[model samples]
Target: MANLAAVVGIGQTKYTTKRGDVSIAGLVREAAANALEDAGLGWDDIEAVIIGKAPDMFEGVIMPEIYLTDALGCNGKPMLRVHTAGSVGGSTALVAASHVQSGTFKRVLTVAFEKQSESNAMWALSTPQPFSVHLNAGAGGYFAPIIREYMRRSEAPYDVGIKVAVKDRLHGARNPLAHLQKPDITLQEVEESFMLWDPLRFLEACPSSDGACAMVIASEDLAEQSPKPPAWIRGVAMRSEPTMYAGREEVSPQAGRDCAADVYQQAGITDPRRDLDCAEVYVPFSWYEPMWLENLGFAAEGEGWKLTMEGATSLDEGGDIPWNPSGGVLCSNPIGASGMIRFAEAARQVRGDAGAHQVEGAKLALGHAYGGGAQFFSMWVVGSEKS
Candidate 1:
């Protein structure tokens, strides 16, 4: 219903455990600069900026975008900060794209980042709020129960999680920008890793990395004139529900399903696994691959693990769908930037610029992100050609 929008540039900082060399502003600028270079444009070409992250407490800085405007080249331009828990990155990009899609801006810049080294994520996640039970443990503690429920409901083997860990780690090795490049990763090693939660091992959890991801989106006309091939945004959608509500299924949230359905409808995808050449899903935990596979309609409920077991997610398997060729969140998770990385990776596949992690002959790709007790979801479908 709005003017078509396409991604002309994508950039990301090298992921690391600690980016002490640069301040948060500097980290974001590096990504923004790279995106501009890739777009064959300059800071002067950007009309506005959209920044996203999880929580201010994580960095001990409130309203960081205000101080970051200059670093992001947003002086004298409209700027917005998006925070939808973990899906903030994807939501931020979607908001920026809307400006282009509405014909309100020719080119817009969107950036997301997180310096987890600034603070312990476990402590940040466990901060107690009034009238809420304090769960002193970290994200693994919060999510392990949901995974346990999935295992029980689906009858998934215990080794399925280990398999996912091994696969994603191997995939991460191919992504030069990934934080964890465990080239020698093996299923035996994953199985032997120290258990963090009941069923989750340290290797199965996403790393708290310092990184940033950025993208330049433009209107259809502007994109057509760009030097680089544009990754046309076929569809974008976001959905949210209360963090905890009666009758809500935490493992397969309705928000994720509804968001996928809306985007798929706009993209004209009748069969996701068959139509989508690849996907970049937010999987901070290895188990989420199969859980999302089912939620995204790539496989029948209780059968998602079957795909993972069959090596259907591998790049060389010639499987119907390849997911997380960028190594995904399991390999590098800058909480604020994780979602944008997924979106950016999808764009890269469509732009034919994924380098070693590229899915062969990829034409259509899905990008997905979720946050906040799995209650928020953002997704986009991209293609090589204009729709």
Candidate 2:
């Protein structure tokens, strides 16, 4: 059995379209330093380090973690690099936690980053892969038709995407670290914005950003030494399925369903809607909010959009189950770091450190991420208590 592990610290740099002020190493260091500061620890306190990011082509740097070791203070310590497409960040954290859970380490440091200004992400993502369709419109192009399929099957309102765009942008305004903060954003603007993908407007798409996120995971004994309350990790899980196959439901993939089911079961959650206090889900595109809701079993198939229309996912006082109170991928998507942001945000909430976006009395929370044709999934549940 795995021993207890807790996320005792989280830190992130100010996300933006371009972080010209810092080098890739500097960007990674900034986030790692902040997390160390939050944990009240120094470089010597860390037992190991794990770093993750997207393809080396995205930043034109090969095995960045090797160079980032000095910046992240991993000298002479075990360091691992993880690349699981966009889900790398969350996966990185899970790998770090595994160290503590296995009784192999007392404390672990994990970081993920993306310096999009170094290279063009769109150009990298759009490159034609062997045996894949050559439409080459980038990720949005690939996911848009899938989104359209969800719309057709669900019969959701035309404004559902607009509503999510408005909600998340407004939430982003409150999070100073977010890249896009449109507090005054409205449904009308999103509805009128130029359409990039059919049924997906420009305002609804996640920005290509340069940013980093870091966290410190520790054993139970070490966790109790933290100055701030620890966000105990109740359960962590990952799942993957073949990228393409006949009759696969990309809209609600079985891998995603299985991932969520496994995590919730690990957390002993029988009724997610009523049991969990809040959730931070990966929503790179506005429509994904509802699509993931069904995949995660938070709402029934073809009815997830109804929850959005009714404001059930709002951060406002009107909603009970606040989703993405930190604005989520729709706000500050540093591709490689987006997934960990969701995971870290969930830990922040349970630790009562969410600041303005804090969900009051959120004893338990969920963090989720998916990547690569929506086939790879990663998730975790965190809570205030050790249990």
Candidate 3:
């Protein structure tokens, strides 16, 4: 086991389709600087650095970390890069936490970013590969079929995806940093939106944006010395399965189920719905809200759809387990940074500083992410009280 670690600071840039105002290096520094400022420190305070993002093709940059050294104030510090498909953001954070938990570093800086404006992620993903049928469509086309399978398996209504789209978009309006701020988005509008993929409407899908997220992870001693409440890292876990296997279940990946179970067990949770106050999960597509509910054990199989139908996951007036109060991946998806945003937002929730989307009296929260054909998974449990 590793030593206790806590998130001391979190930060992000205003997410949008294009951040032409800054270069890739500048984008990451902007977020890192914000986190450092929140932690009441500077570059010197961080003992090491870890950064993550999608493939370099997404930004037309080859191994960005190599050139971002000075930009991130890592000129002479140990810097590492992490990649795990879309889960890279959360994985990066977990790696930084490991440094502090292992007693190898007292404080570590972790950042994840994506500048998709430089290129096209969907095109990069849809590029033909050997032994693959070239549907020639982007991610929406790839995921739409799996979503259809979920609908059939759970017998979910068509409105389920629309409801989630509306809910998360509304939530985005409350988040100043989210890419999309559609406060007036309505379910009917989402239903009528053009379909990108069968059963997957445009509004139901996540946006491609440019953004970055950063966090300062520190040991318990350093966290206790800080003025702000520390988001204690109670548990952290990551798992992966083959991208495609004969018996694999993409809609409800076993890796996702196992990841949640491992984190819950480590955090002393038996009932996720009640034990955790809220969850910031990776839901790039609207239907994933219910799909993840089943995968993460928030609801029983074939019953996750009812939760969305009843508004249990709504931050506006939901119960203890509201999901993605920050609007989730649907609102702000900077591919590499999406998972880190979820992780950071979860920390913000437990820290009681999520602003408009804050869950009332939230003390404990969960952050989850999955990627690469829903094969890679990462999750963590955070709490307000130090232990």
Best by lDDT: 1
Clashing pairs in 1: none
State each model's CA lDDT, in order: 0.93, 0.91, 0.91
For each candidate in turn, the TM-score is 0.99, 0.98, 0.98
Better of 1 and 3 by lDDT: 1
Please report the TM-score between candidate 2 and the true structure.
0.98
Alpha carbon lDDT of residue 356, candidate 1?
91
- Error (Å) of candidate 3 at residue 340 is 0.3
For model 1, residues 79-124, the per-residue Cα lDDT tens digits are 9999999999899989989989888899999999999999667778
Candidate 3 lDDT: 0.91
Q: Which regions of candidate 1 deviate over 4 angstroms?
A: none
**Candidate 1 global Cα RMSD:** 0.9
Candidate 2: what lDDT? 0.91
The deviation in Å at residue 5 for candidate 1 is: 0.5
How well does candidate 2 score on lDDT at residue 382?
97
Task: Kindly report which residue stretches of model 3 are placed more than 4 angstroms away from their true locations once superposed.
Answer: none
